[model samples]
Every structure is written in structure tokens, then in C-alpha cells.
Target: METGVHPARQPGCHPAHNPRGKPKRPTGRTDGPSRKIEVRALAEELGATLIRAVRRDADDELASVGTGHGPVTISWYAFALEYLDMRWPQIAAKTRNETNAALCAITQVMLRDVRGRPNDELLRRALRDWAFVLPRPEPHAAPPDVRLALRWVARTSRPLTDLMDPAVMRAVMQALRLKQDGTVAAPETQRHKRMTFVNAVRYAIEQGMLDSDPIANINWRIAKTAKRVDPRVVANPAQVRSLLCAVSYVGSYRRARGRRLVGLFAGMYYAGLRPEEAVAVTLPDCVLPAEGWGRVILHVTRTQAGKKWTDTGQLHDERGLKGRPPGETRPVPLPPGLVAIWRESIQTFGTASDGRLFFNERGGILAFSTYDTVWHEARQLGLPSDLVNTPLAARPYDLRHSALSTWLNAGVDPAEVAERAGNSVEVLMTKYAKCLYGRAAIANHRIQALLDEYD
Candidate 1:
């Protein structure tokens, strides 16, 4: 058995029936030092002879199992925690948040009884934000009620063996599938949850607690996940330009809340930068010369995973590039219009102490709520009545879709677009660059002396 996971037979299984079927080092040899114990008095009571004493100590069965730390005695919550503890150092902050969320959903249904349970919402908060994650900021300082809720959970949570029961597994499946409102979860979310749960079950099997993985024995399928960006959400250039114009009008000229984000939005629309990448852009990353195409070399992303999950205890964490290695950079060509915008932005806003091009009024990282409100207002203000009701420019990220699809529609080479967009050529062609239907066809109309000739 792996170290620290006490070898246990839940109910039906033995060490010999361990999932790996590699015989456990005959009992007490696994966790710590083993020693010989003569059982002459006990053997005499059982009418056994002394001739078997000459056999190797390794051949003897363990006199007793682990003291209270075995699977039968451990709660499912504790087992799941141990699984996460083993995995913590191997995963990123965002992944840790995701794992915490998945386990929270699974844990809600892992209770022994609800006889004296606390409010469901409060219990979930205690699990999701505090108890499930470690290195938490001042863990002992959790609010009194939250501490009480956690204690209640530890007292009422079912044994790890309950996770193997078919009925409990079905409840777990249901909890993972539907939200509290009874709506089906997103496919990717459901898949993440199942993957986390399966890993926990496999941990049990690895510790010689189970004959097989319960999740593997069950029949279940996650709904299909989407790979390609929806073509409908990809805004074209004209709509994006109008939206940028409207965004500038969002707040009073003095506050400049909406005006501050104009250049930020332009980067995504003109250069295909992701929202997180655009937020982290610093003055040093840009090169805006007098006339021609400028350049922006990308390095990091400042993204949100909540203060509790982030190592910095801030709403956002600055991390390495999404799919690229540390310090690897992607260079994107900037248009002359964007260069002019950048020059104006630097003069007007002056940048944060760290040279970030855009920030909140207090010169801090931009919150999602702030930008989302700005974008929602811009859609209403910029789009035509009919178009506003549609999905055009629905999200700030769609400006990037607008940029990349415009490149593809304008017949740019796939490899070149991929390089500029920081995507593999396959992803550029299949996911990011789906051509919009109307942009090219309605671009212009010619005037002729005879209208029939044009038709």
C-alpha cells in the first residue's frame, strides 16, 4: 500500500483482493517498522501448537488493523481531503478552485443524516471556501458560525465506505448533474466534477481499501463539451468599432470609467488578445511608433479565481501564459489606429505604478463586474434596435473573435493568424476563426447608370 494510506478492507475486500492485486507486504510492514509478537498464551487458548513458531515473521497475519485511521473509521470528507492534499502541490490555483467546487458538490450529499444539519447555504460556504482548501489565510480565524458549521459536518459526515454504495453513488451523480435550481450543469463542469470524484475513488483503491473503483464500475456519461466558439457570438468589425465608441460615453467625462477601457477593448478587437491578457498588458509590452504597424509582446495573464483560492488573497492572480511555458512570449502586430489609441491612453491615464495601461479609478486591477456593466450598457447604446436584441458584440471577448474571424475572412494565412493569436494552427482554424456570414457580403454597393447591369 502507498505510505500514509492505511491498508484497510472496507467490508468485502482483502489485501489480496486489492485493486492492483500486488500482495501487500504481509501486514504491519507497510506504514512503519514491524516487530515480532509471541502469542503463546493466546495460541494455547485456541488449541494451536508451537511448531508454527519457526515460520518467518513475514508469514504471520497482522494481529490487529490500524488504530481508528482505517477507511471504515475515516469519514468520506477526510478521505477526500487527503486526496486533495496529495494533489495540492501538483495543481494550479484555478484548478484547485475547481477541485474545491467539485468536492463541495459531492460533499453536500455525503452526509450521514440531516437530523441537526445547519442551513444548506452556510454549510456549502464553509466547505467550498474554507475547509476544503489549505494555506487558507488565517484558517483559525474563521467566523464562529462557520466554525460551528464545519464541526457539524465533521460529526455527521458518512464513513468512506458509504461512497461505495450504489444508492449513495447515484445521489452523488445527481448532485453533480443538476444545480440547486434543478438545471443541468454545463458539460465541462460536470466532466470536471466526475474526474475529481473518480480520482478520490482511485485513491481509496490505491490504499488497498477497495477491490475496484466504484466510479469505474458505474455507467454514466457526461454531456458533450464544446470546442469551437459559437459563430453567433463573434461580432464583426463595424459593430465592434461602434461598441467601442459607445463604451467611451458610458460614464461622465470626469469619472472616465468607460473611457478608461476603450484602449483595453480595442486591443482585443484589433489584436485578438484575450480579456485576461489584455488586462495584464503593461506599457513595456507595447511599441507604438509614429506611423506603421506597432508590436505587443504578451507574457502573463491576471485572472480571477476569488481571494480565498488565490495565493495573494486578492481577487485576481498574475500567472504565466495559458498554454505556453514560463517566460515564452507571443508577439502580435498592432495596427496604426491602435498605436494612436495607445499613445493617447498613456498621455491621459498615465498608467499604474507597475505600468499597466488600464485600471480602476483607484489604479487597481479592473473587476469583472465593472467591465461587464460597461459592456452591457454599450450594447444598448451602440447597437441598432434590431441588432441590440441579437447577440452581436455580446461579450468583450467576442471582440477577439471579431478580430480573428476578420483575418480569416480577409483571407489571411492560417499559420500567420495562429502565430499572432497565440493558438495552435489547428485551434485557429477550427475554434477561433469561424467566418461570420454578413460582413463581406454587405461591405459595399456600387452605383451604376443602369441598375440592371449591377444586378
Candidate 2:
């Protein structure tokens, strides 16, 4: 039989009496120290003892089971680092950043209530900006504040086993639903965080740390997502043409920034290329004819995820077309007008060194900010004052929206529209549903004709 006394409480461990000659209590509190300090110290000791006991029991159980593998006693922070390492080579830059962000968010609620913990803001920043980017080669040590906060998190984070508890999982879900400012997060943001967390838990299950993903058992309500495109932002054909013309007139006396981007904007309006896809259009991608309609074979997109997210530290990452497999191509048929625009652009500006059709004056990739500034200036120059301030074609992306809407409204088959827009039929029907103007009147007219024939 063993006594409940810790090793520190052994008979010869310490003097039985205090310096003031008071007898030391078995509970180990002395009357000398400040109460707050004593309480904090006691809490720290208790936390450490509890952690050690839990780990020891887990180890003992594994040994009894006769398995060679060690117990799953990793901290949440350590597991997060391991998971990111496992995933880094396979995922896209944007996805990598999102994974890091989601893990950082989860870390906030996964810590034990340790004394002397860093403030919430500091800890969050440290996790997101420093601790979670495990794959990156450290250029330098983190700042003192971030390093301190990171150390606190490493010391205080709950073990991976804690995530198996329903209550702890519930806390994580609640944290996912809120922004750093404590306001409700956007629906998309909530969805992304939940998806990342669920995937992480799934990975945990595969690693034998969890029996099942606790998130699957949780009865949580996800905010409904808004699927339809706002009609106000959809530009009509005439408006798009006017905008394209206005783009030519912008900075005409300067570096011809607007002139250089005309074909790029045309690709968005007529060929329905995403801004990223348009930026990446090379000479080999386009099938430009002198007179008739041409086609663009889009194989890659140059998406601008910040340098820290990309493996190369480049501002843009060259990835497969959005939602498409690597090396798969999407061929979008361009209208004759767009073909004319492309021909003129190629003749005037020529291609970049790497054969990309649209590039800056220095032949580098066109920055999104540069094009956005030109588009805004073109809007002010082209649109009527009232329309200029409204959401009509507010973003370069809105142009692609308008193009899809136009194709749908023109009685083009939904399947064809979806293929051209590089979207699923379901997404085309759901997102661009409201933007398909004049469809209601056409449906009403057809109904009226049928009713008249019956009469």
C-alpha cells in the first residue's frame, strides 16, 4: 500500500518548520507568502501534476495493451504543427493560409486555464502569424512579445485527448462562429473554419488519437449561405461595352495602363475568364482568328495569395483553374468582338517574355491593384454619375458575373453557360439565378400564349 503523499512531501524533503518558527502544514501553504502568489503557485503545481498523471496513466494503459506504439499524449499545439507539416506539400497556398488561420482560431479555446496566461489578442496573433506556419524556414526569431505568448500557449494548451470531450468540442464550435472582435463571423468564414476543424479532427481519428470526429456528433446550426448574385452588380451588354471603351481612354497620355488591359477586361466580359485566369493568359492559350470568333484554352490561374502563403514566396501562385484538377484545361469560346480586341492588343503591346498576353510596362505580371485602380477610373469616366456610385460592375469579378448572367438571359442552355463559366450546373443555377433578367417576362409570355390557345 502506498500513501497519497507526493514525493515532495517525503519526510526529509524540506524543514518541518518555517523561518518564523510556525509548523508547515501538510497542504504546503505557509502564512508568509502573499495569498494571490500562493494561490497562483498552487494552481500551477496542480495543473502540472494533473497533466503528468494523465500522461502517465495513458502510457501505462498503452504498455498493458502490449502495443509497441506510444500513448497519444500530444498537446493540441504540437498536433496542429504535425498536421500542417503533413498537409503543406499537397494543398494550395490559399488553402494553406486558411488552414493555419483555422488552427490558430481553435488554439484560443483549446488551452487550459493556466495562471499567467497571455492576453487573448497577443496569443491569437502569435499563433496565426508565428507559431502555426510550421513549413516555412524561419528567417528570424519571432519578436519578444510573440515568442513569450507562443511559449505560454505551448505550456498551457490542452492535450489532444481533451478534444474528444463534447463540452470541449462545443466550445471550439462556439469559437469558430465568432470573429476576433466578438461579433458573429460571416457565413463563409464560419463554414471554412468548421470545415478545417472537421478535417483536422478526421486526421486525428486516422492517427488513432480520436475514436471519431467529435464535430460530427455536435448538433450545431450553420448560418444559411446567400447563394444568389446581387442583380445590382450585373452590368448589361451596353454598359460593359462602354466600360471597355472608357478603359482605352484612361491614362492614354501616360504608360497606357488602361489600353494594355482592354483585352483582359474583354476576356472577362465576353470569354467569362476570371480575373486571375485572364492575368495568366499566355500566347499559347489563345486561338485568335483575324475575323471570326476565337477560343481561349485556360489551363492555369495565377491567384495572388500573399508571399507568406506561397511556397515560392511569390505574390501569385500558379495553380490549376479553380475547382479543376491539375493540368486540366477549360476552353472558353470568345465572341468575334473579343477576338478583334485580342488581335489589336497583341499587335499594340505584344506578349511578355514568358508569352503572357497581359503584363505591366516592365513585363512583370499585372498587379491586381493596378487593374482595380484602372477599372475604378474607367467606371467614373464611363458610367452616368448615378450608376457610377452604385454597385453596378463594382468589382472586376462582377464583370464575369454579368457575362454569365448575359449568357443565361440570351436563352443559352444552362449546361453550356456552366461549361463556359467554368462552374457546376448547380452553382450556375443557384448563384446566377437572380441575375438572369427578362426570364420572368419570357416565361410569362410563353404561359400566356399557351393559355390563349386553350381559350
Candidate 3:
């Protein structure tokens, strides 16, 4: 007559075979002491229990799998575990042991019961947050932040269930929703976050834990507030000349470094090479005649990190290139003087052990800090302090801008200029349109002369 005592607890009922709507176990009679399976082995044999739609334990039904480390049910939304079960070998083979370990750790964190309901909404959110902030996998594979986050959860949360509270989710959302310290996050960052969360939410829905994806509802337009950068900081011919003269007259203490700096600046300013591309230049990249001018070809670029993200945005090592595909090559041409400079670097830096033309004292790519410091010192000695601070001729990259503007001003065809500098004619004309005055005057004068002849 509808007794409240759990049927399994009724007298004379076999705990293993209780039939009053209790969870079904594997169909086997209990063997004697030596025949009972170990807990872990039973779990393996009972993996089919995962497909059950009803609560198998009271703790789960009551949401009592709290922070004290009691056994908890596995979550339905454990994408990391499912992903690992299916893709562990693939992930391991593609990256390193540390990465594989991180994946495993995260899987454990996500798969642990939350809400005692065998759901992994929180884990999905964590994965989404991580994938959002990480840089695109280039120069190297993904950093260890996912692994770090998993470890953080393990250490910080009491039982994994504690992490599943609605309040916890609210806190997480609040922390992540922060704007970039008054400045907007870069568009790339914003886009990545949205995509990461979107994918994670999609995974959750696919795993049957969610009816729909929450990430799908959030507006992503807030990221658009970040300003677009103008790429036309290149110098004019007069400014280039002044910059060159400034670079040429380094103090005796900095003479050797200055020469190297001049070569780099000239390569970028005169040849329109990105700073990294300039460092990758080699003797073979340069083509010079005994009597006349020739071209320089830039095959690669070297990148550095750390110092660059500092408030100063300076750098200190050679990490990788931009534009070029991994192991595939890209090239740019140079004028006679730049050709000569590459030749001199070849004789001096002696090429990387790998035949790279520029390197640190240890034969690595030159440090951005070393070059930046040298550039500042060069400025102090060569240009007025007022000029040094002004953007008119500040920063190494401005040389590339100057180079492009000079080409536009010197009557070079827009198509030719764009092709040489790896830009579209439309883009060049739009951003640097105001900086093309000198070349426009030349074109105007030549056109006037032609008109005079017609008259």
C-alpha cells in the first residue's frame, strides 16, 4: 500500500535484484567472494549504465554530490571525455605529452557530476572561454591554457559538483564578460571567443545535455567597437632621407649596431619589407650588378614575443613569420643599396647555422629589444628629441609606410605598388591617399607637359 521505504530496502528483497523500479544492473547472480568484480571493473562492465534515462542513486536525485569529494555520477555534457575517448590518439600524435595530459585532466574535470545530474554545462562553458582567448594556432600549437583551466578547477572547486551551481555559472559569466580594461578587445579576440563559445554550446546540445545553445543567444556585436588600425604609417621621401641620415650618424659606441639598424631600416623603408621579413633577408635574396642597381628578395620573416605585449610593445627574440605558409616560402625584391646591405650582413652575421642572414650574438634571430634600443639611441643622437617623439618619423614600421607613400608619390602605377607591397590597390589608395601628394604632383606636371605639347 504505497509504503515510503525504498523498495530495495524492503525486508526479504535482494539488494542486487530489488525489482520495485530500481536501476537495472548487469544480469548476473552474485558469485561468491572471489567472484565479485572490483568497483572499477564493474564500472567498465557496466558502462551500459551510462545510457539509462533515470536516476540510479538517491544522491544524484537529491543533488547531494556536493564539495566533499563523494562519488558523483558522470555528466551527460562531458564533451572533453567523449572527445578524448574518440580522439586521444589523434591529439597525442599531433602535439606533445603535456598537451595530451592536459586534455585528459580537463576531461576528468568536465565529466565529473555537476548538479548531481550527470550534466557538463559548466565544463562546456570553460572550454568555450578558453578557446575564445587563445591565439590562432600559428608559430606554434595552442598554448596550455585549457589544461591550466582544468587544473585550476580541480584545485579550486571542492567536489566537482560545487562548480555546477547556478551561482557559479553566474560568477564565471561575470568574470569573462569583462571589457578590455576600458580599451576594447581586439576584433580577432572577440571573434575567437564568440566562435569558441558557440562551438562549445553546439557540442553540449549535440551531446543531449541541452535543448538549445545559450552561447547562440549572446550578441557578438560588442566586439565590433574595437577600432580598425590604419596600415599607412609609411614615410615620404624627405622623411625617409631624414630617417636614413639619422640612422647613418650613430655615436661611436653604437656604430656597429647602427650599421645593422640602417640595413634593416633601409630594407623595410626602401624595399617595403615587413620588419620580420627584413631580418630573414640573405645574400641570395639580394640581386646586385657590379655597375647598376638590382633587386632584393625577402623569403621569410622572424617574429618575437614577450617584450612586444609589454606596455612598450617591444620584443626580444625570433619566433616566426606572418604572411608565409608553414614551410612554404614568400619573396620580395630590393634596390641596389639594399642588395649591398644584405651582402654585408651575409659576410658579417655569417648566416644562421640554417643559412638565415640575421641573428643574435648566439646565432638566433635578432632581439626586438636590441633593435628597438638601438633605434632609440640612434634617434637621440641623430634627430631632435621633438622629432623623435612625433609620429612623423617614429617607429621602425613607419619606414615601410614611407616606402609605399613614396612609390605612390613617385608616379609608380598603383597596381605595381600594391603588388610589390603585398596590398590591394584599393586598400593602398584609400588608407594612404592623403600621403600620395608628392607622386601626384609629378603626375600632374607630366600631364601638363603633355597638354602643352598638344596645344
- The TM-score leader among the candidates is 2
**Candidate 3 local lDDT, 345-407, one digit each (tens):** 666646677666666566666776776776677666666666666666467776777788777
Candidate 3 differs from the real structure by a C-alpha RMSD in angstroms, to one decimal, of 14.2
Candidate lDDT scores, in order, read 0.78, 0.84, 0.53
Ten-residue stretch with the least lDDT total in model 1? 56-65
Give per-residue lDDT, candidate 2, residue 122.
87
- The deviation in Å at residue 33 for candidate 3 is 38
TM-score versus the correct structure, for each prediction? 0.77, 0.81, 0.55
Residue lDDT tens for model 1, 1-455: 55664446443357556678665466545342233233555666555444344222212211112223444566676666677778777766777888898888888899777676888889888887777887743535888778667766766677777767888888898888877567998999888888877887877788766567777656888889977878888776777888889999998999998899999999998999998899999999889898999999899998877886777789987888889988888888999999998889889988999999989999999888888899999899998998887777788888888888888777788799889988889887778534634344544332333565876
lDDT score, candidate 2: 0.84
1-455: candidate 2 lDDT, tens digit per residue: 78898887876555562456555567855575587887899999999999888655543432232211266477787678777777878888888878888898898899899897888888877887776774543524678777556666766778887887999989999999988888999999899888888888888788777666677778999988888999999999999999999999889657898999999998999988899999999988789988888988999999988788888888899899899888999899988999999889899989999999999999988889989999999999999998998999999999999999998999999999999889999989999878776798898999999999989
lDDT of 1: 0.78
